[model samples]
Target: MVKNVGAVGDFDSAHETALLTATGRNQLLDAMHWIAEGRRLNGEVDGPTLLGALVAAADAGVAGAEPALRTAVRAALRSTLDTSADLVMTDGIVPPSRYEAALANVARRTASGTLVDITGSVVMAAQADDPLVIEALGLVAGLSWRDLQARAYARGTSLPGEADGSWSPSQVFAAFSVVDDVVCGRVEPQVPGAVAARPIELLLGGTASGWAAAEAMREGGVSYGTLLAQRDVGSAWSAHRNRSNNEISRLMVRRVLNALDEAGVGYWSTEGDAAVAKAVLGQRAGASGKPPGQLSIVTRAATGGPGYAVLIAIARDGGTARKTAATLLQLPKRFNVPSVLVLFGTGWADRGESDDLVRAFGGRLYTEHTLEQLAEAASTVGTS
Candidate 1:
């Protein structure tokens, strides 16, 4: 018997009050259709066939099977979209380009409504850690959940949940657990081919692991502040932050190197100048030691200037910018070279301080975020 497939009613009539706009709804529907079609092409039992069977079951008077068949098609469509999201988080799977575009559209729709919708901010705050929202943001922009969390933590900015009564001790434990895992090498960095890809997936997987740790702690009746007070946990987070900053700094350094190479400006590793490299390493040394790789380069100075110029990427705590600036300012006099300090990963909380440092550095300061300007400066280092 031909089982009826559940209704394929118009989306607008079905989800009129959905947070997504009409355009967003249509895009999402199209993506769902694409997924279903792919399944059909792959010889999988498509949604329609499953719905048809459900409808047949309902006609045979299977209890509770009527509603099941009534909206089986629509529900499958929605579930397919959710499955795509889940795959992104759990397996680092990227959805098809069409589905990614649809997610981007939906993210834009939600972001635009955030200002005017009464419950918009609240809803966003509540779902700040949600995997779907995280994936959606990643699709729209390069920002991943880990990037957001790192930025917030770096800047000492409170998340919406932290101030909106939604924060829980469990989240605190989870955060610490994530940091600990990173420090312990349980979550090794996987540098994707593209800088902007799959960070959200990695973060989601880490978060899942963190939640498992949190659950175990809760079962053991650990107090809220217990983990916070642990020196090892605190140190782990500090290490994690340092590592994150170092990664960003390295990327910025690569950009500067590329710019210098393109300009045919001769540059060499700081190792070429032993005294300068030793001094810089000494200046930047911390509990964990100097950052793993070379962060400074020696290049030709302007024609009428000193013999050499030093380009250095400074990756340190934001609060230490002032002290770091003071130390760096002496490089020109002590080393007899013009020093350019690129403040890498300085956060919002210390922006004013960094700006002051930049001004005091006398046109020698750049930031990781302003690579174009930094590149220009690098290119002109020997000519200007």
Candidate 2:
């Protein structure tokens, strides 16, 4: 089933009154913000609407109508909110000073109410934590989830001289890198069990249809796969590989393909940032087992062949870099595949950007001097 990330239309259909009624003014407005920014509010699974429904149900006097919804609410709280303990809340307006207490109270209420007695496999409440609670508050309070991740990195940003001292360049890059991974997650569209490509997905863009690009990264990004074909073109330049092909983009893709073939990794190339975004994000997903975390490649250009490629991540999660740039040598841990090195190069047939492609993507004149080095760099760019 295709899933939509927003609930504006659903909210309108669910609530029906076009004017954004009094009782739901805050709720509707909050819901609208989420819908406008592209997040979901459905009453099913771990969605924002589940919380709204819980409050609504409680307001409506339904005692157990919240079991399924409650479980889902708790699950999201733990995963997205950053709480490590079972979630809890108090009925009244939560005071800033008593936020922790409010959570504990909610936990107590839950433990005494349905949490302690849940027997179905619908939710693993025991493993549920407080981070989940905060996320619920984030959605209800109208806070941006993206800001939450930014705040996490921001913490590391303010620590005395050691802040800049410890953060350095790569550390800072790594923190935001983490934020990049989290903020844009589930944002890119998907194509049947795989994420689809997107033109302006979050901060980075990619080629391949959002869904097609994501699905293209099978094997958890072990190979260059489709994830790197077209990502927000960080660099670009056109080349006339064959006068017959003519356009800079075609030359870029053909060159990239040739490089991948030389490295023995397969790929799914595309023309736009959407398709590339689909591929880049897909490489980090496993869909089964562990979300794919290594051997990455990200190539996205502004429409010129021989586009720019950035060494986003490398040699991570016991994997090899089938294709990716070299400067992404920012992350600490990397899993290198000497024989299965991941390589990346982007550009269109219309313009010439081979210089940027080489510099950012890494190879020849870029960062990698050997297959071993390149393999390691590309492998971890996505996961780290």
Candidate 3:
């Protein structure tokens, strides 16, 4: 009962149902054949190519291509199912029932034509079922689609159709390939805690799920050094370290704000705006040299008590820590308000560098790694 949409070599009147031009028809047939052969060889489907071809055919009003498209979809789904089965058997991380549910979700989404990137969809489904699947997948896959889009934009590569809220299958698959490579141990993260911090960076842009993921990682004793011995964290962070720093900075700000809120402290904050820093601290530029360049957080007690200005910095080692501390020391003199330094991350080069920061901040230094201590410290200034 199925019509062979590719059997006719040319566009002829006899094939009235085939509305595509001869070239278009040929390309569709070729892509379908390639995907079938690929699946046969290694259970891999060239989903982007096949999906692109199908989309092109539909755009060209080729109604006859539907049958071939359906067949290709079936093949792709089967390939993913097979791979999931193997993962369940080998890693035992994904349960069979969970895989089945994920497959069913993919099937429905694909049926509606909203899920062109089959592999990414599968990984996303697994992520929804268990966020830890991201770690299990070597921390390369399972990023939310929005995070993936942001990362792509940061890399100066805009995924096709991203503006319309539809993901291009090719771009999604290409990103997923990095995950596959990491899963296979073909790539590794350059930084020790980059794996744990990546999701935090990507999801820090106002998503509660991202904050939950960070909290979960912290409670589970997962840190940047937690997976230092694992050889499969992927190099996404190193490849985009500059962007990662900005993201981590944002994450740190959010963490501090959240901690402050939990401690019932009333305060206002800003991100690197010198004017706001001057206004909140009520400091004039005439006598003081200038507002600090990286004035991250400025807050006062709701009852009009003494305010606190916080400078957040990230230091990977003792040298950077010392340099950051020295820089931080210069800013407090410009402001009459009390100043605090909130340092994030692990791996201080030496205890002395931390001591210098504490002494510089007048014993008001806080580390984000300790949330409870951070909250307790933050509560000191504004809750009087």
Among all candidates shown, the one with the greatest TM-score: 3
lDDT of each: 0.39, 0.30, 0.46
lDDT of 3 by residue, 328-374 (tens): 76766666676666666443424344433433444344555444444
| TM-score, every prediction | 0.31, 0.17, 0.36
lDDT of 3 at 91: 39
Query: What does candidate 2's lDDT look like per residue over 156-240, in tens digits?
Result: 6431222212233433343333333333353445466855322233224345332233223211231332224322232111111
Q: Any runs in candidate 2 off by more than 4 Å, and if so which?
A: 1-131, 141-146, 152-351, 355-384
Highest lDDT: which candidate?
Answer: 3
Worst 10 residues of 1 by lDDT: 79-88
Clashing pairs in 3: 193-224, 318-349
- What is the Å distance of residue 110 in model 1 from its true position? 58
Q: Native-vs-model 1 lDDT?
A: 0.39
Clashes of 1: 0
Q: Residue 262, candidate 1: how far off, in angstroms?
A: 2.8
